[model samples]
Target: MHGHGNVPGMDAASEVGVDVRWSETLRTYHAVSNELEHELQAGHGLGLSDFELLKALCRCCAPDKGTVLMKDLEAEMYLSQSAFSRTVTRLEKAGFVERAACGFDRRSNFLAITDAGSERYLSAAETHRAVLDKHFG
Candidate 1:
């Protein structure tokens, strides 16, 4: 449809749709994030980003071995210092995440996912998996 030479059902836009791939990827990620967040909100009563942060922290084996440093969370979550701080604050408010001074590095702080946080993560993860199956499968 873009030009005269374009064949039926083979318009230039149809043939070359890669321009929107980046946007599509971002949109998909956002949709998935929102879906998981909605499930958590309904079932576990936790915010989206806070649930995600707790899940990430729990993945660091904090539950078994204890705590993970704040810097480690920032690096793993790829969040800016201010944004990450805000997330941690929200988590702390929700009783899912907590921060403490790193014993080894006094200047650095540590993050821990609490029991409630772990349970919430597991429940949200199951819901997330079901949503993925419903949408992607």
Candidate 2:
């Protein structure tokens, strides 16, 4: 009888509070993502996903082996398979990333960051970090 609609363990006031919190969190996330997307696109002609892929590739690069396997790259991505593939294709077309057939596994492809990609990532990283620092720091 104390709860909303006479439901047990559920109250109108508590439900409203939870909904408000969830909405606020989502709104904040979207706002931050939008700001980053705008800044990156304006400064480097790269979208947030593009920048993330390039940065991941750079981190995965080794001195002797500069490429990361497609499977490995997929693990680091937040996008769906189709979306990730599309972004990769776009970056490849832009000459920022190159894909090579894996010598060991015919079914696997390796993705490597080109010199241009590295340069672009490094430039955009500064701006990305600055924005994060401003908002979260």
- Candidate of highest TM-score: 2
* Angstrom error at residue 101, model 1: 1.5
Q: Any runs in candidate 1 off by more than 4 Å, and if so which? A: 1-15
lDDT of 1 by residue, 1-137 (tens): 35666376657676467648877888988987788778878977776666667767877755567588888878777578898899899888888777887777789987877787777778877876787887688
Cα lDDT tens digits, model 2, 10-78, are 477788798899999999889889999999999999999999998888887786777989778878989
Cα displacement (Å) at residue 48, model 2:
0.8
> Which segments of model 2 are wrong by more than 4 Å?
1-17
| Count of steric clashes across candidates, in order | 0, 0
Judge candidate 1 at residue 87 and give its lDDT: 89
What's the TM for model 1?
A: 0.75
lDDT of each: 0.77, 0.88
